[model samples]
Target: MQFKNIISGAAVLLASAPAVMALGSATVVNNCGYPIYFASVGQSQHANMQPLQGSYSEGYSQQGVGISIKLAPNNTVGGPVSQFEFTWANGKIAYDLSNIDGYPFSAGGMQVVPSTQGDSSNPTCVPVDCPAGQSVCTAAYNAPDDVRTMVCDENTSLTLTMCPGGSAKRSVEVREHIRYRVHARHFTVEQ
Candidate 1:
């Protein structure tokens, strides 16, 4: 009888334990003058399709799996779109801005800024600021082999802004070497 009681008590304690929390969080801000629609694409689930008008914001947390926040000026999915991709795992968050599909916000731009500085040894922890009208931003992955991935501490919060201010106009030479490369695959979740 005592053995059975001990087993029952252990099961109760295990069941009452707190669930494992996600290691990363992201906030999306719409700084554009018009409304934009965003969808969260993850390995298992795709959700949160909502319209964000100027100055509005939405936030979410996710486990250490690949996720992409797809944004577009219109509500439809076939039109021009951009993406912010991230995966939080192994004590770090690997992230990148992808213009591989298309860039809808040419007049405005997008940026991903980390809440805190990442590992000092990793130089790719800097912010990814893709200026307006830059179709081939060097800070983003322009091709499948583009070396634009950045990393930050897993606990570092990230803020993604659409149409951020001070997006200076700069001319960047499109890398002729990878111009013909195919677009890299992006995260997608079935509805």
Candidate 2:
């Protein structure tokens, strides 16, 4: 009789173990703006981006176009919204990024105002100062008035954004976007 009772107790403990584990994971939480897309500084493997097909304003000027691409649902993708490799011939760019990742254009012309609005906003450094050994701190291209800006050129600048992880339930470590500013002329003289 005692042997049968022990077996029954073991079965009851096993049955309740699952319930306890399920209760531990019962709490649900989510964040909408966690994985934000900001400017990066290099080429991305995500080379299948298509054009947004519309004019987007950076601050006051409108020069560049926009596109909406399906960010491939993968965990291996990473970049700061750098130079949009627009394959105009192929009618494709690399990725579609409005809120996700992109460079907003000014209205006047190709002369783009460097600002940290969309992909330019997320800088890796704090406003105060860069840590020891670091030459220049990474900052979003915000100061259009200042000659030195992060978003100097597309070749040097990069685009970055967040994407879903390998597993939906698994938590992913967030990384900051790093874009290198390319050489650009702020003002020009027309003859």
Candidate 3:
């Protein structure tokens, strides 16, 4: 009877653990000429707006539930922003590039590359490549119900690059209505 109780308790503990525990780390790299700000939103711990200059990388880990890393050209919130969204569940990481709000980095472009080839069981596992100046990229989510999500192995880390090749000329207008907020620390930035 004691053994049975122990087994049941163990099962409960495992079930309660956050699914994001299976997810690998995520790294965001800024390759654009100007500084870009990023913030994380969703079930995981929220991150405040933080700046990343050219040629710098930021690494972070997500907790349970879904998370979206939003990027903007300036250190503000609530404007046209590009997002890298993901959820880790059942040993797979489902991810997508979201432009539903707007594509603030259309002039520079962005890419999300998984460290490993997508698991053979999933066909939608592939890198999201939004070319420079492409305001409407089909590879990313344009609407709420867009079928653009991709899946990869649970252990596969991701590298999100802004302006993949080199610095892109700024073409998007920085709207004046954006709400400014104080920056907070939640991730490690590497040069």
Candidate 4:
């Protein structure tokens, strides 16, 4: 009886392993009066992304970012899909869902409307996790408000949905009615 129990437990764990590793979501909501386009990027190193060149190579954006696996290779979102997926490991991931390049600065627009769930402290399993308005730099190279970080002890799914034009924070850089708040949720990925 003891041997049978151990065998059954191990089998269950093995069967559910793939489903766990292949987990994560970034649901971008377009609250800006106009449409929005952006990418959910996961980088092994967080310090190098700057100037906003959306590429799936160069060690960072390659982790996978798209509406679906079918549209992810290009890693751009503007069509029918509104969801994204990526893999996380090594306890933490450096990531961001940004629309800086696509944002109509000339039109005085804002993107990434998040809820009050946006957090600064290095938290575990919290959805829509972001760093404090980065003081690391003030130039264009500085981390955008959309920049985020995730820390969890086990394989987890951290998600954030931006509700722009809602009750989100307003940046001083651009003086427009456009605001964003990110709501987050952390939960275990099950088989």
Candidate 3: clashing residue pairs, number: 0
State how far residue 152 of model 1 sits from its true place (Å): 0.7
Quality of model 1 by C-alpha lDDT: 0.73
Query: Candidate 4: where is the Cα deviation over 4 Å?
Result: 1-22, 39-87, 97-148, 153-191
Ranking, lDDT, top scorer first: 3, 1, 4, 2
Positional deviation of 99 in candidate 4, in angstroms? 8.3
- Encode model 1's per-residue lDDT on 1-191: one tens digit a residue: 99999999999999999976455577788877677888878875555666865443333355566888888777866766688888877778888988787777766778899887756766677899988776667787767798888887776678888878844332222354423334477544432
lDDT of each: 0.73, 0.26, 0.80, 0.33
lDDT string, candidate 4, 1-191, tens digits: 99999999999999888754433333333332333334433432122212222222222223332222111112243322222233444434433333332222212222222122334544433443223333221111123463443344322333332332243332224445644544476534332
Predicted candidate 2 versus true structure: per-residue lDDT over 1-191, tens digit per residue: 99999999999998888542110000001112222222222233344433322221121111243322222223222432323211111211222112123222111011112222344433421111112222222222232342222222221212322211111221233477665554585544433
lDDT of 2 at 102: 21
* Residue pairs of candidate 1 with colliding backbone atoms: none
Off by over 4 Å in 3: 1-23, 44-47, 53-64, 174-191
